[model samples]
Target: MSQLNKNNLLPLESPKVLWAVAISFLCIWFYMLGARTLVPTDEGRYAEMAREMLATGDWITLRLNGIKYFEKPPLQNWMNALTFAAFGLGDWQARLWTGLCGLIGVFSVAYTGRRLFGARTGTIAAIVLGSSFYWAGMGHVNSLDMGLSGMLAITMCGLLLGQDESASPAARRNAMLICWAGMALATMSKGLIGFVLPGAVLVIYTLVTRDWRLWARLYFGRGLILFFAITAPWFILIALRNPEHPHFFFIHEHFQRFTSDVHHRSGVWYYFFPFLILGIVPWIGLLVQGMWTGVKEQQKGFKPLLMLLIWAVFFFFFFSISHSKLPGYILPIFPALALMIAVYLESAKPNALKLAAGLLGLLGVVGLFSVNKIAHMGKDAIDIPLYANAAPWIAAASAIALAGALVAWFFAGREKVGKDIAILSLAFGGFLAGQVAFLGHNPFGQYIAGTAHVAAINAELTSPTTPIYAVGRYEQALPFYLQRTVTLVEFPDEMEFGLQQQPELWIPTRAGFVKKWLAHQANHEHAVAIVRTDIFEEFQKQHVPMRVIGQDPRRVIIATPVPSQ
Candidate 1:
């Protein structure tokens, strides 16, 4: 009912309200995180790596499916391993690091916005960051990108806070130190991009804004020492222990992976465009306006808004030029964009708010109408019936989002801007949580993780050390669910380097795998091998002595046939 002034602009102004919101976010994050089974390639691989580290007591060297995996740094794995140690292994524990990082990133953006702009801006920024589709989705999964993006947000926030000339000397010093520590942790989370992207942003910002004096405030000598202290030990230890760790991690993972397309993940220049558009979702209209506003808002001394615009732009273009690209690569830019939009929303006219809400409502309506098509689109890999079962939940969530947007639009039209923003934020957050809890996990569990088949295999295996082979394919979730490493039989897709390091652990060809299967049959050992259904049929036609033990549409687990009595 009250018109928002500078003092009363923030919707949840009381400390109690803030704490309540923070706790609510935490509950949603952890709940959604635990509700989902780990997806393959990223979630399963990372979780398996952490599991291996905890089991083997090897914190430095990371492994996937018992093979040396140096594609990324070990910070995320280390955090996950520590979580597993504290909480015991499960989906929640595996995702704890990313979830925590997401929470921290939200707070960091809020704090940064409050300090630079106003309290209202800060609260809005937190809501936007927390409710964003990509940010929230990635946070619930075990991915390195969320952690890296979170740390980078801290790095950017710290730098922005420290750059303020009016800040006390001690506060500035502490902020710079935070910046350095954030950079270190970020580097540990992913690799060089932690330092590279932020460093590039600072350079470009300085060059464009002509703020050379900001360099003096960086506390370079002490900062560099602190950074090395936090980041160097793991690299040094891993290199000393594994002779090939440094080259593969530093050169192959970082340099070669960036400069060349050795990973075969090449994409066109605009590969990230769709992700950027859809990632922000309901806020897309506001984000575009915010970007324009951010660019136009130049002020005397330090320009925080302009700096954020440059940060987002530099991050976008940096990844755009890279030889390889993934949707998660642009995550770090979302917080910056959120802050900009928050600032815009703070002083925005009610009409503008209404327009944005109406558009969001329309988008939700469109999604609801297209739910069937969206669910059926993945039928090639997923069971259509099982996947389509999530359509109702998705439609319900979309309807809730639409209802909230319409209500917010009403509030905005009635000049209740703060209520409008609050309602809109709550709606989006609910939609995100509902989608994650109801829709995101089950399809992935059915298709990617093969949870039923893995559970069946685990049930069938009498011994923890039962020999299981992955023939012609590697299911990333198998080792994690079974709580044991699978022997690779003619399957070295991404584990070629690890296979090279320990050649004896893998059968090099399909023929070699058949020979091993015959040997197990001759010895009367109860051995199982998971292979594609087509491959299993082919092997069966070859008169391989195996019986189906467990199966899914995509894969089958076959064991050595019991001898005729």
Candidate 2:
């Protein structure tokens, strides 16, 4: 044992269990502060549905834009709707429940790490999991990612702990029975992919390791009974109430989404290389070093270490081979990797860590640079101050983490390099905060407020219940902002859906509106706002008339029908 090992931080062999609990609480508190901080992303859509459910008093069907939106399960909406009912339609209120779910992931990893490895391994594992962009990014948002991730981590942790003793009746219950329950929650969170990938990984792992004996731990009779008790009730209730849901959800949504490119989320073969490289963040160096060291020393005997390397690699290739891809698809494997990295670091020689920390610190700087450049492109594209809002905090955090690197360099010979890096985890935390500060969600009621602005300008012409039709297409964000339903026009068959609907608003390309009007639709629709911008001049060149009632870089509101009393 090293000098630091002799002066153990905790009397227990592992401190990670306690550290994990502490970190989970801290992360929750941090996120809880600005539940209303940024606007929701995909979160807004879910939140709005919750709002609609409350508005219309229909909870089971889950509607968006007043249309049936059953693509995603209603777990998030249920949570958000309950929050909104309790606390009002506030952003944080809706997000708070889901954020708590994310904290479950942190707790799962920390506790599981300690249970599977030891205190040092547990702490590093929790930190690695916490530092991951996957969960943390999901943490502050109102999305299914965190909930799905939480259930996954819990189930995996149970499975890991189950490896300890198949014969123990209690362990069997917690590990197999309870683990299956967590799998059910994951399925509820995002359909069946929740249980599917992890189940697949476990089967493959058991096969390769020749560990069918682990199956004995499952206690098939008790396990099956408990699994149905926990998971089946909800499926039965939902499927019976919404009968068509079974065919659409089971066959079309899950199977088709994975096996085909139907969703069109397809990316190149190596889509995740960049995402993973950035997703690990400030600790990319340590993670890389940890993975490398873990792989090289696998013959030295780290079961979780060996298992995770195989797990992450298998899922990576598995999803890459699949027809559909999204950045969040790889989330399940991260907790295992984090734990593995933690274990590898805990087992590393004292002198080796300094070089590792320095390399990681440098890698963080490189990641920041890449993200900054891409953000600039986003800034140009969105014409908003997105990158501008994000750069300073990111740059500063990188600089500080690098300084911590220097500190680690000087203290490399010390036995507590793992401890030092944990302390430095907050520097990475700062980058996340900075990123949030910049890209902070517009909080509901913020964006497309051009919608509200336009409504105000045309309020005399319309009302709280006005019949306004949107020609061509519309942004759903705008309608939510305006609190109105819009009518969409079809192809050249305008006389049917178009003239009959006769929308007051025409949010279409200048070319489409011009073609429709010129075809004897009406001379009245001649004066258009975007027409000047798209037809006569680029959006940047056009100066809108009628009124400069409200302005954002994305929109310019103007009065349409002069005014009515």
Candidate 3:
């Protein structure tokens, strides 16, 4: 009987619930702020591709590495290109659209939750998940994750709202239209996977639940026209213009990239489970607990719970089975997870809530403690970096610890406070993760930008024709950061096929082509010398006309072709 009060979610005027949501939103907004530059993980490529679009004024073809890039569609790049047009090719501008899309996603999640559950669940879920590390981190990034997440949420909302039995015909039609448009935008954001995956899930859910009639009423006649109307022109334009792109992008780049090791992103199955946990850290316990409770409550017929379970399970396995893997691939499921958890917290038993608080607190404490140990880790001695905001992260550590204790106390009185604490704690977890990883010195700091040595090399050896070769392999970031052509030395086949150009001078990999280069040195009459692939190699140690540079630990640099001085 006491659980009855717990079941009745907090009233709209509840100060605790309001504060929890407000705090969560503020934290998420702050966490994602000022992180609008192209980082190594595809940001540089995306930004650069947009830059190329702006430079050539060719909206029809999307090229990366100087070759026709047919992998994904062009809406994101077009949005990014527009940003570039408005603000030049600046990193901040190029990435602004991504952040904006993230904001849209956050808003969609909140709106969807509110409609499906209640104000308390909607606002809290929005706030908590708004501050989520995965969302925050990917939000500001110039990648497809944030945009896809935004479109996915909008589509899910439309689908869910369309399912409302009492909705007016106009409302249902609006939702169906949004669903189609969202699918179109989502496909534009990534590739076919965006529509295929979501479509598969929705179809399966409707089939299992015996709601297939929803499709007929989706107004596909009009919705399909609108979808193609919005999403088609670009595909028609790009495909017609690039000629060989549609097949290459659809089949080889998008499909084969998933089914093959071509991108070298293969991983053991279940890898994303850990990433999913970490991705929504601080919220992991709450999310899992909510999911577990939702599953248990299936007998009671919680439609939202079942929907999210299916949503998460489908995306999890679909990408997990694919040969390609990336951290952002699973972002679409988080909003569903967030709403599900929020709904459960709003509706779970007090004892269950008590268990949730303990789990969330315990998990947060462990995370804070682990970060404490990592804080003292030395930099330069290794790849680890503790930057300017290290102090802030450390400062938040105690607060995080306090949040755990607060969780325990919240449940001691009004059990409604359990959901409030649960939601707020998840936000704090997201804030902490974003602060630790991106703001300052962390292992990620190194990957975020090219080495200053590269900049110094740029300053020294930079001429209109200095010929910057990326010693052996390739990092697409080189072109965007350096604003020059970076030739890959060994992957000549890829360079020819992708980049469609060659370098003036070849900086051979010392280890890979030692004998071949040595024989070349012997056969050549010109004054020739070989350099090692390290920062401190003989000719590369002291800064000359050029110097070696690196983006990460594994990649190295060695300069060559002193330009016939």
Candidate 4:
């Protein structure tokens, strides 16, 4: 119950109180996690992939829409498949792996901060990380990035713990082993960057700090053995089973993905700068101040702060130079930044907390006013009315966050840092609640996810084996919802390689599809195809025999008429 002084430094809360608070926050985090729906392109795609893996009983080789998918390693998919097995497939189950990894990342940061700094800093670090917009949002979503980020955090923390001179040789060895294992799991989660980023950061840190003695204590011999042991079996098994796995996964997925615009995800060099600034929302100013303070503060043997700075900067530039860019790519750097900010926040003045709170409140007001703009931004993809309908939920969430920030500001003015941190935590919870509300509204998913239409198709099917086709485009969510793979007709977007491997399973063009459809109808076989709305009309003009089964604004599902007896 001790209040913070004017300088805003406060003693650590008792262990019992801290644990209770952590447990309570975690419960709230999990409760709000299930409120959102699984979205397309990533969430639905990954979930369906895991579901397919579970259904096919083939663990070694991964597949998406019944095609070999080698774009990512199988660690996350393995975890998700297991989750689906333990619990029934649903929104929360699909997201469980990412969410769990994020929670682990939070605790790992807390433990590492406590060991390196103090209990107070550790506690603050957890709060900062668990509450950040990027960390919180990505944690609840199904994505490879969060799992990779979380594993890398553990790797970095393990390295820090192991390299401490004060720790016993035995403890350091064990910690280094943990570091190796962390890297192995991280690699399994997201391929090369897991190893590349951590290795690069360590090398740079050692060269700059001139810590030549540090490598001796790293226990490299045993560590490398552990790393290879944990990471090699899957890669070897996958390669042996599928001859093309190594070339595609290691070369095309990693090398080509980075150096060329093969994925067509090109962005300007400063693309991530805005995302990074906005991602840590309401904490940007504090982050800048915290980083500056970290640079100035000197530590004796090894400089954890400098190493963290190197980690953040290196990741930023490393991905910035890549042809492909995404907001989640920079997620791994957040925990380091959170720890840096926690260190500064522990000793910051009350006025600093007040200023941050005020800024957060201002952001809330802006969010309230920007609903229409946000709704219109997605007009090309979704019905604007859907976004308008979802706006109130977002507004309510923003209001709650705004209120919490104001209360935190009041507490800060009273020199009560603990109360201020507590309020800010609630504010972040509100932000996440808003995100869930918006996602749950299913505005975007309604257009992209073929679940409802697939359901309609399923209801009308006379047999489970009825042939289905996707013409000219692939709906990422359709296979998952239908619980069956559809034959491709003239579309090979990301599935080009897979289609090449199984040419017998696809129709090469609209003409080929028409021929196949007539053959199926002549044989009295029921066949259905989902096509773009425009393509459906074109087919209708061509006088192709079709009966519309289901239609959405973006797509239409039609079936071959049953031949009269």
lDDT of all predictions: 0.82, 0.59, 0.64, 0.81
Q: Which ten residues in a row have the lowest lDDT in candidate 1?
A: 429-438
Instruction: Pick out the ten consecutive residues of candidate 4 with the lowest summed lDDT.
Output: 3-12
Off by over 4 Å in 4: 1-20, 372-382, 416-441, 562-565
Q: Native-vs-model 3 lDDT?
A: 0.64
Q: Which tens-of-lDDT digit does each residue in 1-565 have in candidate 1?
A: 4444445554456566668767776776778877877888788888999999999998888888888888888889889899999999898888899998988898999999898888878888888888877888888778899999999999999999999877899999999999999999999999988888888988988998898988999999999999999988988998888899888888888888889999898899999999987678667667788887767986788888888999999899988988988889999999999999888877777766766677677877886898888578655534666657777767777777777677677677454445645445644634463454355446657566777777667755767667898888998876887788888887798999877888888888889889988998898777888898888999979998888877777788888887889
Tens-place lDDT digits, model 2, residues 1-565? 7554676653224457445646664765565535443243465566677788878887776666565555677777778888878888665775676677767877788787777667667766766677665566667666677777778777777766766652367765667766777777777778877677767877876776676776676556875676667667667776787676677778877788878987788888999888786666545656666676446544422255555666678878888877888877777767767776676666566455665566557755765676567347444443445555445545655565566566656655554644454434433443344344334333222543233354553453334543333343334444444445543333212122222223343333444543543442233221223112232234235442233344454554333333334
Candidate with top TM-score is 1
TM-score of 2: 0.77
Q: lDDT tens digits, residues 270-337, model 3?
A: 87987787676545546777677547554422255576778888888898999989888898888888
For candidate 3, the TM-score is 0.81
- List pairs with backbone clashes in candidate 1: none
Order the candidates by TM-score, highest first.
1, 4, 3, 2
What would the per-residue lDDT of candidate 4 be over residues 1-565, giving only the tens digit for each residue?
A: 4443543454346555566766777886786567666777898779989999999999888888888888899999999999999997888888899999999889888998898889878887888888777888889889899999999999988998898778888988888888888999999999988788899998999898898888887788998899899889999999898998899899999999999999999999999998887677657658788788657867888788888888888998999999999889999999989888888887788777766777777877887797768666545434666677677766776676687677767677554445545445544644555464556376556566766686678865679889889988788777776777888888877878877776777778989999999998888888888998888999989999988888878799998886776
Q: Candidate 4: which pairs clash? A: none
User: Clashing residue pairs, candidate 3?
Assistant: 385-441, 385-442, 386-441, 387-441
Evaluation by TM-score, superior candidate among 1 and 4:
1
